[model samples]
Target: MKVLVTGAAGSIGRVVTVGLAELGHVVVGLDRVPQPDGEDSAWHTVDATDADAVAAVFEEESPDAVVHLAGHPGEASLPDSLTSHVVTTGALLDAMVEHDVRRLVYASSNHAVGRTPRGGPPEAGPVGADARLRPDTFYGVAKVAAEALMSLYADRYGIDAVACRIGSFLERPETVRHLATWLSPDDCVRMVAAALTAPAPGFAVLYGISHNTRAWWDLAPGRALGYEPRDDAEDFAGIIEARPEDEAEAAHVGGPYATAQFERPALDRTS
Candidate 1:
Protein backbone atom coordinates (compact mmCIF):
# COMPACT_ATOMS: atom_id res chain seq x y z
CA MET A 1 0.00 0.00 0.00
CA LYS A 2 1.16 3.56 -0.64
CA VAL A 3 1.09 5.53 2.59
CA LEU A 4 1.41 9.25 3.24
CA VAL A 5 2.94 10.27 6.56
CA THR A 6 2.43 13.82 7.76
CA GLY A 7 5.10 15.28 10.05
CA ALA A 8 7.47 12.94 8.29
CA ALA A 9 10.48 14.91 9.57
CA GLY A 10 9.51 14.52 13.20
CA SER A 11 11.18 11.98 15.46
CA ILE A 12 8.40 9.41 15.37
CA GLY A 13 7.50 10.26 11.80
CA ARG A 14 11.04 9.68 10.62
CA VAL A 15 11.07 6.24 12.21
CA VAL A 16 7.61 5.28 10.97
CA THR A 17 8.41 6.39 7.43
CA VAL A 18 11.45 4.16 7.32
CA GLY A 19 9.59 1.32 8.98
CA LEU A 20 6.74 1.49 6.45
CA ALA A 21 9.21 1.50 3.58
CA GLU A 22 10.96 -1.57 5.00
CA LEU A 23 7.59 -3.33 4.99
CA GLY A 24 7.38 -2.76 1.20
CA HIS A 25 4.91 0.11 1.37
CA VAL A 26 5.61 3.24 -0.65
CA VAL A 27 5.85 6.16 1.77
CA VAL A 28 5.17 9.75 0.77
CA GLY A 29 6.65 12.01 3.43
CA LEU A 30 4.99 15.35 4.19
CA ASP A 31 6.31 17.95 6.57
CA ARG A 32 7.03 21.67 6.85
CA VAL A 33 10.75 20.84 6.81
CA PRO A 34 12.63 18.49 4.58
CA GLN A 35 14.10 15.31 5.96
CA PRO A 36 17.88 14.84 6.09
CA ASP A 37 19.72 13.14 3.25
CA GLY A 38 19.68 9.32 2.93
CA GLU A 39 15.87 9.06 3.36
CA ASP A 40 14.91 7.11 0.24
CA SER A 41 11.23 8.05 -0.19
CA ALA A 42 9.04 10.64 -1.82
CA TRP A 43 8.73 13.82 0.27
CA HIS A 44 6.78 17.07 0.16
CA THR A 45 7.10 20.27 2.14
CA VAL A 46 3.65 21.47 3.10
CA ASP A 47 2.03 23.09 6.08
CA ALA A 48 -0.62 20.75 7.41
CA THR A 49 -2.90 23.57 8.58
CA ASP A 50 -3.16 24.92 5.07
CA ALA A 51 -6.22 23.22 3.61
CA ASP A 52 -5.39 23.98 0.01
CA ALA A 53 -1.83 22.80 0.43
CA VAL A 54 -2.82 19.55 2.11
CA ALA A 55 -5.56 18.88 -0.44
CA ALA A 56 -3.20 19.53 -3.30
CA VAL A 57 -0.72 17.05 -1.90
CA PHE A 58 -3.42 14.45 -1.29
CA GLU A 59 -4.72 14.94 -4.82
CA GLU A 60 -1.24 14.52 -6.18
CA GLU A 61 -0.09 11.61 -4.02
CA SER A 62 -3.40 9.73 -3.98
CA PRO A 63 -2.15 7.65 -1.08
CA ASP A 64 -4.02 4.58 0.10
CA ALA A 65 -3.48 5.45 3.77
CA VAL A 66 -2.29 8.31 5.97
CA VAL A 67 -0.51 8.38 9.29
CA HIS A 68 -1.45 11.81 10.59
CA LEU A 69 1.26 12.88 13.05
CA ALA A 70 1.78 16.54 12.22
CA GLY A 71 0.87 19.07 14.93
CA HIS A 72 2.24 21.25 17.67
CA PRO A 73 3.49 19.15 20.52
CA GLY A 74 2.26 20.70 23.80
CA GLU A 75 3.84 23.14 26.26
CA ALA A 76 3.67 26.17 24.04
CA SER A 77 1.44 29.24 24.03
CA LEU A 78 -2.22 28.21 24.11
CA PRO A 79 -3.39 29.61 20.79
CA ASP A 80 -0.49 28.29 18.76
CA SER A 81 -0.86 24.84 20.24
CA LEU A 82 -4.59 24.67 19.73
CA THR A 83 -4.52 26.01 16.19
CA SER A 84 -1.75 23.71 15.11
CA HIS A 85 -3.32 20.64 16.69
CA VAL A 86 -6.92 21.26 15.62
CA VAL A 87 -6.52 23.15 12.36
CA THR A 88 -3.85 20.91 10.93
CA THR A 89 -5.84 17.80 11.81
CA GLY A 90 -9.03 19.25 10.35
CA ALA A 91 -7.32 20.10 7.07
CA LEU A 92 -5.71 16.69 6.85
CA LEU A 93 -9.00 14.91 7.41
CA ASP A 94 -10.78 17.05 4.88
CA ALA A 95 -8.11 16.36 2.30
CA MET A 96 -8.20 12.66 3.02
CA VAL A 97 -11.96 12.57 2.67
CA GLU A 98 -11.87 14.53 -0.56
CA HIS A 99 -9.30 12.15 -2.01
CA ASP A 100 -11.14 8.99 -0.86
CA VAL A 101 -8.27 7.93 1.35
CA ARG A 102 -9.89 5.19 3.38
CA ARG A 103 -7.43 4.44 6.14
CA LEU A 104 -6.15 6.93 8.75
CA VAL A 105 -3.99 6.30 11.78
CA TYR A 106 -4.24 9.40 13.96
CA ALA A 107 -1.65 10.20 16.59
CA SER A 108 -3.94 11.02 19.48
CA SER A 109 -2.44 11.30 22.95
CA ASN A 110 -3.07 9.67 26.33
CA HIS A 111 -3.53 13.25 27.56
CA ALA A 112 -6.95 13.28 25.93
CA VAL A 113 -8.09 11.28 28.95
CA GLY A 114 -5.36 12.52 31.23
CA ARG A 115 -7.42 13.55 34.23
CA THR A 116 -8.40 9.98 35.03
CA PRO A 117 -7.10 8.68 38.31
CA ARG A 118 -4.22 6.27 38.05
CA GLY A 119 -2.87 3.51 40.32
CA GLY A 120 -6.28 2.38 41.41
CA PRO A 121 -7.33 -1.09 42.51
CA PRO A 122 -6.46 -3.93 40.16
CA GLU A 123 -10.15 -4.36 39.36
CA ALA A 124 -10.34 -0.73 38.31
CA GLY A 125 -7.84 -1.59 35.60
CA PRO A 126 -5.97 0.85 33.38
CA VAL A 127 -7.70 3.38 31.18
CA GLY A 128 -9.27 1.79 28.12
CA ALA A 129 -10.77 2.98 24.86
CA ASP A 130 -14.10 3.42 26.61
CA ALA A 131 -12.73 6.05 28.98
CA ARG A 132 -14.35 9.45 28.83
CA LEU A 133 -12.47 12.56 27.82
CA ARG A 134 -10.87 14.60 30.61
CA PRO A 135 -8.15 16.49 28.81
CA ASP A 136 -5.57 17.96 31.16
CA THR A 137 -4.35 20.79 28.95
CA PHE A 138 -5.27 22.88 25.93
CA TYR A 139 -3.10 20.59 23.84
CA GLY A 140 -4.93 17.57 25.16
CA VAL A 141 -8.27 19.25 24.54
CA ALA A 142 -7.28 19.75 20.92
CA LYS A 143 -6.54 16.06 20.59
CA VAL A 144 -9.95 15.24 22.08
CA ALA A 145 -11.56 17.50 19.50
CA ALA A 146 -9.58 15.86 16.71
CA GLU A 147 -10.80 12.44 17.84
CA ALA A 148 -14.37 13.65 17.57
CA LEU A 149 -13.68 15.00 14.10
CA MET A 150 -12.25 11.66 13.07
CA SER A 151 -15.37 9.95 14.41
CA LEU A 152 -17.55 12.22 12.33
CA TYR A 153 -15.59 11.60 9.15
CA ALA A 154 -15.57 7.88 9.74
CA ASP A 155 -19.29 7.59 10.44
CA ARG A 156 -20.43 9.95 7.72
CA TYR A 157 -17.81 9.45 5.03
CA GLY A 158 -16.73 5.79 5.45
CA ILE A 159 -13.20 6.50 6.57
CA ASP A 160 -11.50 3.82 8.65
CA ALA A 161 -10.09 6.16 11.32
CA VAL A 162 -8.08 4.77 14.17
CA ALA A 163 -7.29 7.18 16.99
CA CYS A 164 -4.12 6.01 18.66
CA ARG A 165 -3.96 7.26 22.26
CA ILE A 166 -0.21 7.28 22.35
CA GLY A 167 1.64 7.28 25.62
CA SER A 168 5.11 8.75 26.26
CA PHE A 169 7.03 7.99 23.12
CA LEU A 170 10.69 8.14 24.10
CA GLU A 171 13.90 6.59 22.99
CA ARG A 172 14.16 5.01 26.43
CA PRO A 173 12.44 5.07 29.80
CA GLU A 174 13.71 8.07 31.75
CA THR A 175 11.64 7.91 34.90
CA VAL A 176 9.23 5.79 36.91
CA ARG A 177 6.21 7.17 35.07
CA HIS A 178 7.89 6.24 31.81
CA LEU A 179 8.17 2.63 32.88
CA ALA A 180 4.43 2.38 32.65
CA THR A 181 3.82 4.83 29.80
CA TRP A 182 6.77 4.51 27.43
CA LEU A 183 5.98 3.69 23.81
CA SER A 184 9.00 2.20 22.13
CA PRO A 185 9.68 3.19 18.53
CA ASP A 186 9.33 -0.37 17.30
CA ASP A 187 6.00 -0.81 19.11
CA CYS A 188 4.83 2.48 17.69
CA VAL A 189 5.62 1.24 14.19
CA ARG A 190 3.92 -2.07 14.90
CA MET A 191 0.80 -0.31 16.12
CA VAL A 192 0.57 1.83 13.01
CA ALA A 193 1.15 -1.17 10.77
CA ALA A 194 -1.63 -3.07 12.49
CA ALA A 195 -4.01 -0.14 12.24
CA LEU A 196 -3.32 0.24 8.54
CA THR A 197 -3.95 -3.45 7.80
CA ALA A 198 -6.74 -4.18 10.28
CA PRO A 199 -9.99 -5.31 8.71
CA ALA A 200 -13.13 -3.23 9.02
CA PRO A 201 -11.72 -0.81 11.56
CA GLY A 202 -14.48 1.71 11.02
CA PHE A 203 -13.61 4.05 13.90
CA ALA A 204 -11.61 2.83 16.84
CA VAL A 205 -9.31 4.03 19.63
CA LEU A 206 -6.22 2.05 20.54
CA TYR A 207 -3.54 2.63 23.15
CA GLY A 208 -0.07 3.05 21.66
CA ILE A 209 2.37 1.68 24.21
CA SER A 210 4.80 -1.16 24.58
CA HIS A 211 4.28 -4.50 26.36
CA ASN A 212 5.49 -3.04 29.63
CA THR A 213 4.55 -5.12 32.66
CA ARG A 214 4.01 -1.90 34.57
CA ALA A 215 1.75 -0.36 31.96
CA TRP A 216 -1.32 1.34 33.36
CA TRP A 217 -3.10 1.49 30.01
CA ASP A 218 -4.81 -1.58 28.60
CA LEU A 219 -3.53 -2.97 25.30
CA ALA A 220 -6.51 -5.22 24.49
CA PRO A 221 -7.98 -2.69 22.07
CA GLY A 222 -4.67 -2.41 20.26
CA ARG A 223 -4.39 -6.17 20.12
CA ALA A 224 -7.84 -6.37 18.59
CA LEU A 225 -6.44 -4.10 15.87
CA GLY A 226 -3.65 -6.68 15.28
CA TYR A 227 -0.94 -4.90 17.32
CA GLU A 228 1.17 -7.08 19.60
CA PRO A 229 3.88 -4.95 21.16
CA ARG A 230 7.16 -6.71 21.90
CA ASP A 231 9.26 -4.18 23.80
CA ASP A 232 9.05 -3.40 27.52
CA ALA A 233 10.35 -0.34 29.39
CA GLU A 234 11.39 -2.61 32.20
CA ASP A 235 14.35 -3.58 30.08
CA PHE A 236 15.83 -0.21 31.11
CA ALA A 237 14.83 -0.60 34.73
CA GLY A 238 18.31 -1.52 35.86
CA ILE A 239 19.89 1.32 33.95
CA ILE A 240 17.49 4.20 34.54
CA GLU A 241 16.87 5.67 37.94
CA ALA A 242 13.31 6.06 39.12
CA ARG A 243 12.47 9.51 40.40
CA PRO A 244 10.06 10.20 43.23
CA GLU A 245 6.79 11.84 42.28
CA ASP A 246 4.49 13.89 44.45
CA GLU A 247 0.98 12.82 45.36
CA ALA A 248 -0.54 15.22 42.84
CA GLU A 249 1.61 13.84 40.07
CA ALA A 250 0.84 10.28 41.11
CA ALA A 251 -2.90 10.91 41.11
CA HIS A 252 -3.46 11.54 37.42
CA VAL A 253 -2.39 9.88 34.19
CA GLY A 254 -1.04 13.07 32.62
CA GLY A 255 1.26 13.95 35.52
CA PRO A 256 2.71 17.46 35.02
CA TYR A 257 0.61 18.24 31.98
CA ALA A 258 -2.43 17.86 34.19
CA THR A 259 -1.13 20.66 36.40
CA ALA A 260 0.84 22.94 34.10
CA GLN A 261 -0.05 26.62 33.96
CA PHE A 262 1.17 29.11 31.40
CA GLU A 263 1.48 32.24 33.45
CA ARG A 264 -0.34 35.26 32.01
CA PRO A 265 -1.72 38.51 33.28
CA ALA A 266 -5.46 38.68 34.03
CA LEU A 267 -6.00 41.18 31.23
CA ASP A 268 -4.17 38.94 28.78
CA ARG A 269 -5.98 35.76 29.70
CA THR A 270 -8.22 35.98 26.68
CA SER A 271 -5.28 36.62 24.45
Candidate 2:
Protein backbone atom coordinates (compact mmCIF):
# COMPACT_ATOMS: atom_id res chain seq x y z
CA MET A 1 0.00 0.00 0.00
CA LYS A 2 1.10 3.56 -0.66
CA VAL A 3 1.00 5.57 2.57
CA LEU A 4 1.36 9.30 3.22
CA VAL A 5 2.71 10.34 6.62
CA THR A 6 2.36 13.93 7.81
CA GLY A 7 4.93 15.47 10.18
CA ALA A 8 7.47 13.07 8.75
CA ALA A 9 10.35 14.79 10.56
CA GLY A 10 8.96 14.51 14.05
CA SER A 11 10.16 11.95 16.62
CA ILE A 12 7.15 9.70 16.08
CA GLY A 13 6.80 10.57 12.41
CA ARG A 14 10.38 9.57 11.67
CA VAL A 15 9.76 6.21 13.29
CA VAL A 16 6.45 5.57 11.54
CA THR A 17 7.67 6.55 8.07
CA VAL A 18 10.67 4.22 8.20
CA GLY A 19 8.82 1.39 9.87
CA LEU A 20 6.00 1.39 7.30
CA ALA A 21 8.53 1.35 4.45
CA GLU A 22 10.31 -1.61 6.01
CA LEU A 23 6.98 -3.40 6.12
CA GLY A 24 6.77 -3.14 2.28
CA HIS A 25 4.56 -0.07 2.02
CA VAL A 26 5.44 2.85 -0.25
CA VAL A 27 5.94 5.68 2.24
CA VAL A 28 5.53 9.33 1.22
CA GLY A 29 6.42 12.03 3.74
CA LEU A 30 4.88 15.51 4.22
CA ASP A 31 6.00 18.18 6.67
CA ARG A 32 6.49 21.95 6.93
CA VAL A 33 10.24 21.64 7.08
CA PRO A 34 12.60 20.17 4.51
CA GLN A 35 13.14 16.46 4.62
CA PRO A 36 16.13 15.43 6.72
CA ASP A 37 19.32 14.16 5.02
CA GLY A 38 19.92 10.41 4.51
CA GLU A 39 16.18 9.60 4.43
CA ASP A 40 14.90 8.12 1.17
CA SER A 41 11.10 8.42 1.18
CA ALA A 42 9.43 10.84 -1.29
CA TRP A 43 9.20 13.97 0.90
CA HIS A 44 7.00 17.06 0.48
CA THR A 45 7.75 20.26 2.40
CA VAL A 46 4.21 21.53 2.88
CA ASP A 47 2.47 22.56 6.08
CA ALA A 48 -0.64 20.48 6.76
CA THR A 49 -2.57 23.63 7.64
CA ASP A 50 -2.29 24.83 4.04
CA ALA A 51 -5.30 23.22 2.45
CA ASP A 52 -4.25 24.05 -1.11
CA ALA A 53 -0.77 22.68 -0.61
CA VAL A 54 -2.09 19.60 1.11
CA ALA A 55 -4.54 19.05 -1.71
CA ALA A 56 -1.77 19.34 -4.29
CA VAL A 57 0.26 16.71 -2.52
CA PHE A 58 -2.72 14.37 -2.52
CA GLU A 59 -3.17 15.04 -6.21
CA GLU A 60 0.46 14.25 -6.91
CA GLU A 61 1.09 11.29 -4.64
CA SER A 62 -2.29 9.58 -4.84
CA PRO A 63 -1.52 7.53 -1.75
CA ASP A 64 -3.76 4.69 -0.64
CA ALA A 65 -3.83 5.78 3.02
CA VAL A 66 -2.63 8.51 5.34
CA VAL A 67 -1.09 8.48 8.81
CA HIS A 68 -1.65 11.95 10.26
CA LEU A 69 0.88 12.93 12.94
CA ALA A 70 1.35 16.61 12.17
CA GLY A 71 0.38 19.13 14.88
CA HIS A 72 1.53 21.05 17.94
CA PRO A 73 2.70 18.35 20.32
CA GLY A 74 2.11 20.33 23.53
CA GLU A 75 -0.07 22.92 25.23
CA ALA A 76 -0.68 26.13 23.28
CA SER A 77 -3.09 29.04 22.88
CA LEU A 78 -6.64 28.00 21.94
CA PRO A 79 -6.61 29.35 18.35
CA ASP A 80 -3.18 27.92 17.67
CA SER A 81 -4.19 24.60 19.11
CA LEU A 82 -7.28 24.43 16.94
CA THR A 83 -5.40 25.43 13.79
CA SER A 84 -2.59 23.06 14.52
CA HIS A 85 -4.75 20.04 15.19
CA VAL A 86 -8.32 20.54 13.98
CA VAL A 87 -7.71 22.72 10.94
CA THR A 88 -4.87 20.55 9.77
CA THR A 89 -7.04 17.49 10.15
CA GLY A 90 -9.91 19.16 8.30
CA ALA A 91 -7.67 19.98 5.39
CA LEU A 92 -6.42 16.41 5.14
CA LEU A 93 -9.88 14.93 5.35
CA ASP A 94 -11.05 17.24 2.60
CA ALA A 95 -8.14 16.30 0.41
CA MET A 96 -8.72 12.63 1.14
CA VAL A 97 -12.33 12.96 0.04
CA GLU A 98 -11.41 14.80 -3.14
CA HIS A 99 -8.71 12.31 -4.02
CA ASP A 100 -10.75 9.22 -3.20
CA VAL A 101 -8.45 8.12 -0.37
CA ARG A 102 -10.51 6.03 2.01
CA ARG A 103 -8.30 5.40 5.00
CA LEU A 104 -6.94 7.68 7.74
CA VAL A 105 -4.90 6.56 10.75
CA TYR A 106 -4.87 9.55 13.10
CA ALA A 107 -2.35 10.16 15.84
CA SER A 108 -4.80 11.27 18.49
CA SER A 109 -3.68 11.53 22.12
CA ASN A 110 -4.79 10.37 25.59
CA HIS A 111 -5.25 14.04 26.43
CA ALA A 112 -8.61 13.87 24.61
CA VAL A 113 -9.85 12.21 27.81
CA GLY A 114 -7.17 13.67 30.05
CA ARG A 115 -9.41 14.64 32.93
CA THR A 116 -10.67 11.08 33.49
CA PRO A 117 -9.42 9.50 36.71
CA ARG A 118 -6.93 6.68 36.23
CA GLY A 119 -8.23 3.12 36.59
CA GLY A 120 -6.96 -0.40 35.82
CA PRO A 121 -5.77 -3.64 37.32
CA PRO A 122 -4.85 -3.59 41.04
CA GLU A 123 -6.71 -0.29 41.38
CA ALA A 124 -9.94 -0.32 39.33
CA GLY A 125 -11.32 -1.28 35.91
CA PRO A 126 -9.52 0.22 32.90
CA VAL A 127 -10.90 3.25 31.08
CA GLY A 128 -12.62 2.13 27.87
CA ALA A 129 -12.26 3.81 24.48
CA ASP A 130 -15.84 5.07 24.65
CA ALA A 131 -15.09 7.27 27.69
CA ARG A 132 -16.59 10.74 27.58
CA LEU A 133 -14.49 13.68 26.47
CA ARG A 134 -12.91 15.56 29.38
CA PRO A 135 -10.00 17.29 27.73
CA ASP A 136 -7.38 18.73 30.09
CA THR A 137 -5.86 21.51 27.99
CA PHE A 138 -6.53 23.43 24.80
CA TYR A 139 -4.27 20.95 23.05
CA GLY A 140 -6.48 18.17 24.29
CA VAL A 141 -9.61 20.04 23.17
CA ALA A 142 -8.17 20.29 19.68
CA LYS A 143 -7.66 16.53 19.64
CA VAL A 144 -11.27 15.96 20.62
CA ALA A 145 -12.51 18.31 17.93
CA ALA A 146 -10.32 16.61 15.34
CA GLU A 147 -11.67 13.24 16.40
CA ALA A 148 -15.22 14.49 15.90
CA LEU A 149 -14.27 15.55 12.40
CA MET A 150 -12.87 12.10 11.68
CA SER A 151 -16.11 10.52 12.85
CA LEU A 152 -18.23 12.86 10.76
CA TYR A 153 -16.22 12.24 7.63
CA ALA A 154 -16.24 8.49 8.14
CA ASP A 155 -20.01 8.29 8.52
CA ARG A 156 -20.70 10.61 5.61
CA TYR A 157 -17.98 9.48 3.21
CA GLY A 158 -17.45 5.76 3.83
CA ILE A 159 -13.96 6.49 5.12
CA ASP A 160 -12.14 4.29 7.55
CA ALA A 161 -10.87 6.58 10.29
CA VAL A 162 -8.95 5.07 13.19
CA ALA A 163 -8.05 7.32 16.07
CA CYS A 164 -5.21 6.06 18.25
CA ARG A 165 -5.09 7.78 21.64
CA ILE A 166 -1.39 7.52 22.17
CA GLY A 167 0.22 7.31 25.58
CA SER A 168 3.69 8.48 26.67
CA PHE A 169 5.83 7.67 23.65
CA LEU A 170 9.46 7.32 24.69
CA GLU A 171 12.57 5.27 24.07
CA ARG A 172 12.20 3.79 27.54
CA PRO A 173 10.24 4.19 30.76
CA GLU A 174 11.83 7.14 32.58
CA THR A 175 9.35 7.90 35.34
CA VAL A 176 6.96 6.05 37.63
CA ARG A 177 3.94 7.16 35.60
CA HIS A 178 5.55 5.85 32.42
CA LEU A 179 5.35 2.31 33.78
CA ALA A 180 1.59 2.47 33.30
CA THR A 181 1.56 4.65 30.18
CA TRP A 182 4.66 4.20 28.04
CA LEU A 183 4.17 3.43 24.31
CA SER A 184 7.35 1.83 23.05
CA PRO A 185 8.58 2.88 19.58
CA ASP A 186 8.12 -0.60 18.18
CA ASP A 187 4.62 -0.86 19.56
CA CYS A 188 3.77 2.53 18.13
CA VAL A 189 4.60 1.17 14.69
CA ARG A 190 2.57 -1.93 15.38
CA MET A 191 -0.44 0.14 16.44
CA VAL A 192 -0.29 2.31 13.31
CA ALA A 193 0.13 -0.69 11.03
CA ALA A 194 -2.84 -2.42 12.59
CA ALA A 195 -5.02 0.65 12.21
CA LEU A 196 -3.92 1.03 8.60
CA THR A 197 -4.72 -2.55 7.51
CA ALA A 198 -7.70 -3.47 9.68
CA PRO A 199 -10.48 -4.49 7.29
CA ALA A 200 -13.24 -1.87 7.07
CA PRO A 201 -12.87 -0.27 10.52
CA GLY A 202 -15.45 2.44 9.84
CA PHE A 203 -14.67 4.65 12.82
CA ALA A 204 -12.66 3.29 15.77
CA VAL A 205 -10.79 4.57 18.80
CA LEU A 206 -7.91 2.60 20.31
CA TYR A 207 -5.53 3.27 23.20
CA GLY A 208 -2.01 3.49 21.85
CA ILE A 209 0.13 1.80 24.50
CA SER A 210 2.26 -1.29 24.89
CA HIS A 211 1.21 -4.33 26.88
CA ASN A 212 2.21 -2.67 30.13
CA THR A 213 1.46 -4.69 33.25
CA ARG A 214 0.12 -1.58 34.99
CA ALA A 215 -1.82 -0.08 32.09
CA TRP A 216 -4.68 2.23 33.07
CA TRP A 217 -6.53 2.06 29.72
CA ASP A 218 -8.35 -0.82 28.00
CA LEU A 219 -6.36 -2.78 25.40
CA ALA A 220 -9.31 -4.84 24.21
CA PRO A 221 -10.31 -2.20 21.66
CA GLY A 222 -6.87 -2.20 20.11
CA ARG A 223 -6.64 -5.98 20.20
CA ALA A 224 -9.94 -6.19 18.35
CA LEU A 225 -8.39 -4.09 15.58
CA GLY A 226 -5.41 -6.47 15.30
CA TYR A 227 -3.07 -4.20 17.25
CA GLU A 228 -1.06 -6.70 19.28
CA PRO A 229 1.39 -4.60 21.31
CA ARG A 230 4.60 -6.45 22.14
CA ASP A 231 6.66 -4.25 24.47
CA ASP A 232 6.03 -3.78 28.18
CA ALA A 233 7.21 -0.80 30.23
CA GLU A 234 7.62 -3.09 33.25
CA ASP A 235 10.92 -4.26 31.78
CA PHE A 236 12.50 -0.92 32.70
CA ALA A 237 10.70 -0.46 36.02
CA GLY A 238 13.96 -0.98 37.93
CA ILE A 239 15.50 2.14 36.37
CA ILE A 240 12.50 4.43 36.95
CA GLU A 241 13.00 7.01 39.70
CA ALA A 242 9.93 7.31 41.88
CA ARG A 243 9.17 10.97 42.52
CA PRO A 244 6.67 12.87 44.68
CA GLU A 245 4.88 14.04 41.49
CA ASP A 246 4.28 10.45 40.38
CA GLU A 247 1.22 10.19 42.60
CA ALA A 248 -0.42 13.22 41.03
CA GLU A 249 0.60 12.19 37.54
CA ALA A 250 -0.89 8.76 38.06
CA ALA A 251 -4.09 10.28 39.40
CA HIS A 252 -5.49 10.87 35.90
CA VAL A 253 -5.33 9.32 32.46
CA GLY A 254 -3.48 12.29 31.02
CA GLY A 255 -1.04 12.65 33.92
CA PRO A 256 0.45 16.18 34.37
CA TYR A 257 -1.73 17.53 31.54
CA ALA A 258 -4.70 17.35 33.91
CA THR A 259 -2.88 19.52 36.48
CA ALA A 260 -2.98 23.28 37.03
CA GLN A 261 0.20 23.84 35.04
CA PHE A 262 -1.81 23.50 31.82
CA GLU A 263 -4.62 25.84 32.86
CA ARG A 264 -4.95 28.98 30.73
CA PRO A 265 -7.50 31.54 29.64
CA ALA A 266 -9.75 30.19 26.88
CA LEU A 267 -9.16 33.30 24.79
CA ASP A 268 -5.70 34.54 23.93
CA ARG A 269 -5.54 38.09 25.31
CA THR A 270 -2.18 38.94 23.75
CA SER A 271 -3.36 38.50 20.17
RMSD of each: 2.1, 1.4
The runs of at least 3 residues in candidate 2 whose Cα sits more than 4 Å from the true structure, single-residue gaps closed, are: 119-124
Q: Please tell me which predicted candidate would have the highest lDDT against the true structure.
A: 2
Global lDDT scores for all candidate models: 0.87, 0.94
Tens-digit per-residue lDDT, 84-122, candidate 1: 787887898888888888999999999998889887788
What TM-score, over all chains together, does every model reach? 0.94, 0.97
**Whole-model lDDT, candidate 1?**
0.87
Once fitted onto the true fold, the runs of candidate 1 whose alpha carbons sit more than 4 angstroms away are 246-248, 260-271
In the predicted model 1, the residue pairs found to clash are none
Q: Model 2 — which ten-residue stretch has the worst lDDT?
A: 117-126
